[model samples]
Target chain A: MAALLETLTEDQRDALKELMNIAMGQAADRLARLIDTLVILSVPSIRLATECAPDLSDCPIFSAPSAYITRQSFLGALRGEVLVCFEQDGADELASLMGFDENLNTDEHDELMLDVTNILSSACIKGLAEQLELPASFGAPSILATNSTLFDKVGDVINRDQTLILEICFKVESHSFTCDLLVCVARESLPSVIEAINRMLEDL
Target chain B: MAPLSDLLRAVIDELNMGVMIVDPELRLELWNRFMAMHSCRTEEDVQGRVLFDVFPDLPEKWFRQKVRSVLELQTLAFTSWVQRPHVFDFAGSRPITGKQSKMYQDTTFFPILEHGNVTHVGILIADATERAVQHQIMHDLNQRLSQEKVEQQHLIEKLEEAQNQLLQSEKMAAIGQLAAGVAHEINNPIGYVYSNIGSLERSAQDLLDMVRAWREAVEASGAPELVEKLDDLAKKYDFDFIQEDLSDLIAESREGAERVKRIVQDLKDFSHVDKAEWQLADLHKGLDSTLNVVWNEVKYKAEVIKEYGNLPEVECIASQLNQVFMNLIVNAAHAIEERGTITIRTGCKGDEVFVSVSDTGCGIPEQNLTKLFEPFFTTKPVGKGTGLGLSLSYSIVQRHQGRIEVESEVGRGTTFTVWLPIRQPEKQVDE
Candidate 1:
């Protein structure tokens, strides 16, 4: 489980976290601008994918039975999937902030979730890809499943044996909306991602 | 031989979903058969045209941003049927359901990368009308089921309430029948005992007069032996004191028996077993009789005050009206924790006669005032009240083509006024 973290030097891990922090900040800024509100972005954390799966029960969002999950696949120099989780109440708040109806029908809610996931995931992934000098293309964000089944569905998508998970939290200040974005990349893709980061670092 | 490009074009044309490719300038470059069928435009006619120019209803700003995102990020973007019902304005194909006239669409925009930069974007649109309709049907069914559940719950509550009312009335009817029988049975024995005491009083008076006459005769005859013997007998028997106390005892007994007879009569009147169902009756007489029947319950708790006014005889079921009065008066008594006043007031206004029972007791709270007549709604402790008194009174008043109104102040007191029509309506008799 610690092999992924052990493989990366402390300097490489710090550099990756810093890069994600900036990318997520840009994403949060885009959302804040879109909704005309303050968005607080959390410091990105780099961890092994296996560590996150087993500890998902400790996350407040996944503990709920009605958490909404959205998954989008990105491909380029680095290729993996980005999974975003929103608690039911947080999703409702986000929908309301996006000028959706307070009483959103199921279809409307699903659309809202996908729309948000598309906007944030694309912006953040694009920012990270651009910073690393890696051209990444993302697929259309699609709703996975809600509730406890989310974990099983996510597990089916990513290879748990060799994946690095970059966890980021996006919070809309003064609102009851928070979303967790987990970027899972295979260990095989990590070398290329690490090479891109090292290249950017040496250039700096 | 057909070229491979031509074969690929034929395959694309045969697909069911609409497919189109738009360049960076937003000009349509390729239009498939499905797009041509839905847009009603041939490939040659729309090939060089701007996308929005062909469909002016397209959300210009949103579509521009979506395409720009795909071009800039070189990533696929999506628009669901929920966001925009349809992009191409195609008619629904379902002839049977035909629930939606406009086709519901889920559209996708994918970047067609050339070398390293995207040159054109491919738009794929899938008809989602059937799925949308199915989802709507399911949502409607769920809403209807929830509404039906609510209505069913209300019906169950109503059935329970009706059952409670039936039980209360049955209990009251049984009590009423028993009271009528007991009053009748007691009336007989009290009547004879009263008559017997009257006769015995007269006989004792007559005997005493004869004894005095005999004594006078003895005195006139100057018979010393007989006078001495009579004096001795009088001293032994204390005859004079016996004669004095005997008449008083008989008179007291007669008074007591009279009281018993009056109580029986009052009980019979309260039950009104022999009275006609609907007749012209004095409200004051009903109030007095009901008060007498419940006097024991109120005497120690409150003082009774009657402020009578000239009232016309109201046509009603007197027994039921008396029951209402009994319920209200006893409720007033129960309300008062200590000595208070229960004012019985009566008056006539136009064609209506009003009787009110007012009490200087703990008043009903404002929140509970509206629910006062609801069955099983009570402030009294459990087992102390059946909570059906006011509800039954309200029903009884309604049956008489009348209304019961109440006014209360929290710390002051409560007044319950019942209004009865001077003449019972003919329609009420059928009810």
Candidate 2:
């Protein structure tokens, strides 16, 4: 309902935005360390959508001709999902930046992408939960789609209304490589997240 | 009811799944009846002992990380049997029918929180052996189905190719029948034309002789006026040239008619529509007829040479043998690039008659020599060949209890020699 959407006042929204930036910054640091390259992360933009279908269609990841999408689910206080979208050529760019000497076969390529997804999702979700004084447990990451632009693959997971969409872009400096990570908090977990954001706002 | 704690303890012990609790150091704090039954170690036996010390076969590194993740995050962590089966190394639930000796399990770890501090990790192990077995069976069935699908596709392609080849041979047989009918009709007309030309030649010669005799008598009669008049008329009409041209014209006409008769006879012999059964036949006559039958194909590409030796009559199906001969001769003609020689030789050794057709044309490659008789194998482009010529010839030769030998050198030439016995085997003769 619109009541749920307006629950996060301007000050709470600002606090949530600040928390997301700090969490994504930590994820970028971990990735940069792993690949031995400078990784630049954009300030995460947060939005609450009452309609599930329109939000995903408007996402830039689906605007791409094709992309490799990975999904990892987290449980406990921060129960939701994280989606990592690698552009059509993002896999090769990341592989090269990671100093893989030989061309990766299909399985190896999928494994590498999933590993990257795990590293990013675990780091970002854990960091965000810690900031909110909550615990987060991660499931195994899996490839959701390759060479597909259909939003249905991601839409089915975020079926409920009053969903929070957090979008961040990761870029490898000195390379044309870029990827998007979307953190979706399920409707059931929204109130706890909002309460945590309001608590942080009050403490400030 | 007893105290709530005691009631819960009883329920946990009687459950069908394995329940165990380990402290931060992985020291076992509790073990349920399900775990004790499978491991044969009661809670008292495993008390104060590390989980690995009790079960040495456990994957210590991976299990520790899974538990550590749950404890540090203070949340639940899980693993499916598909990801890692046999987490506990317990005996399988199904003793007799289960293929695996160890039970497949799906393990989950829950962090027990006290006052916002993690104290123990509760591990729950569920028996998934039946589901694992069913999944394996489904996987194996899927693999076999896909393999059979590939084999079915190949068989379909082979069947389609065989059908096409049969249709091609059927078309050739129909054409052969039509050619035989046409040859039979032409034979009658050719026969009369040949004989009529011979009779006309003789009649013309007789008339010329009579005129010559009369002229001689008149010249000898001593009538100067009559002789002078005859001489004048003969000179005016150029009678000498006419007499010479008349004999030449008759001879040429007879030769042409005779050639037509030979062509019709060649067509009849090539087809052998009337006498298709086994019989004693001269192979030399068959070879000559086959060569004439394919002469149009050869004339532009090659010259024909014959080296005939004495060949006793061979008992065989003449029509089938003619077909073999036609295939070989035509193949030889096609092998020639621009112009070459097709040498056909026939001879008899002991009771076997061998006929070889050699061509001085582009030779076959060494690799293709063995596959030459296999059906549907052709070097010729599509639509140019049905690839059944040599295969049909091979079968026909096999039916006659004969074999064809080939010798060739690349860029030089090829020779195909067919050897047949003078008589069919006694058993074959009876048939």
Candidate 3:
């Protein structure tokens, strides 16, 4: 079967990018307020693929702590994964500054990560939804590990050829952050995306 | 007319809170008037509707989870927070609703049953607002207590850090109290190395001069006088012996260097077991290094006599025990102010290894021996002690599941004996 995307016309792609830019900017602003940090979200690289493993090389999680993050997933018309990852070193450095011990194991490390993630991801996800004119709520968060094989569960449906990955960086204060957003569909959902974004940007 | 159940239900409804009754499948059986007023939904509207369908706007995960557990796991679900709380919509009820001073207490979900199967779940909301506020206050108080404990621990660690610095300076202070002995210890090797270097340099210089002289003699007299002398000189100096001796000297120097390295390393390990915890530590190793730390204190006042026997690696916090050893050794030295011997004997007996440090100094008064292990009850003068040394030792030994025994006679001095179990408690090993 062909990808759900029938080659998007350049104009449609441009429109989607521009709309995403606006949505992400709004999300970044919301995150900045929550984490009390300056946030810079890159215009996410949107690709067309599904159900096959996506190349995770350029993933910022590799350069960051395997812990300390907040992620929210929305599963419906357009199923994808959204993440807010913070560097554990940054966390340790922050803890050091706060005069906390640096010997936190995976559990404490994750707990701190979740506390921040809860605030950051919730704010950003809600802001994006509000812009999209969707009155949806977020799910209770489950802390995740970036350095392990567990991350693949974020998009279990993602595969080599059909799944799409849309990742953005959400910075907190001076610390840089990244969110990996994976969108998967058996066929293209460009029209739904275009429609959703159009409504969101206009409403905002 | 069914006035009885209605009357009883009406009384229950008049009580504070919104209560709802749902069947096994979450079919809304009853929604009170309060729920109707608060939720803006009549009982007839939600009477047969599933909980999730009615509260679709609610957090799906939190709601679906409680619903799933109420059915599958057959357990009630509950949540509470101090501020900015989440409320479950009922016909006319809420959780912890009142003045800020009368915040809601704990809220709970109950699984109601009928006919031995869970047929109904009663979602009851109580105005625990008062209990909630009290609990928050208590929680805040507990946090303050724990924060104080952490502050105390931080101070203790800081004090320990300062103590470690003092001990390091003491080790390096070279107070020259026993400068002669230390000088001898260092000089014995330097002496040989210096002499060997001198002889080697002299021999090499002679050889060079002889070679030059031989070359000049051959050039001047066409004879080999200097050459013969050179050969004769080599034999007299036992060139073969010097050759063999030179190799041995180098080997000896290397060995001495290695010994010095081990001594320095042991000093480090003894001075501060950085982690201050347990490992595959040899009690004998700890004892030896501790002796080095207090060597200066023990050297002149009392001779350290070690009676080492076969001992296994006792699982224990090594640094803590090192502190114990220092305390006992220094005490023993102080006891023998009139110049006596401090004997340290270590051996394994069954599952216990006993280390006894006996001194010929003034022994403890018969009754005072009991107070020796109590923190801050030191026999040493005020400035000389923290009083925590023996208490700390006792606790460290106790943590290792070990015990300390003291034997004393006024004239014969005192012997502090420590018995450590071969297998330490797992929790102790963790520390």
For residues B82-134, write the lDDT of model 2, one tens digit per residue.
65677788988989977788899987788887787888999999999999999
- What tens-digit string does per-residue lDDT give for candidate 1 at B79-100? 8786677777888868576868
Between candidates 1 and 2, the one scoring higher on DockQ is 1
lDDT winner between candidates 1 and 3: 1
* Candidate 3 RMSD computed on C-alpha atoms after optimal superposition onto the true structure: 22.8
Q: Please give the range of 10 consecutive residues that has the lowest summed lDDT in model 1 chain A.
A: A57-66
TM-score for candidate 2 = 0.65
Complex DockQ, candidate 2: 0.14
Rate residue B20 of model 1 by lDDT. Answer: 86
Candidate 2 chain B weakest ten by summed lDDT: B68-77
**Full-model lDDT, candidate 1:** 0.81
A19 in model 2: Cα distance from truth in Å?
Answer: 3.4
| Top DockQ prediction, candidate number | 1
Can you list each candidate's DockQ? 0.24, 0.14, 0.01
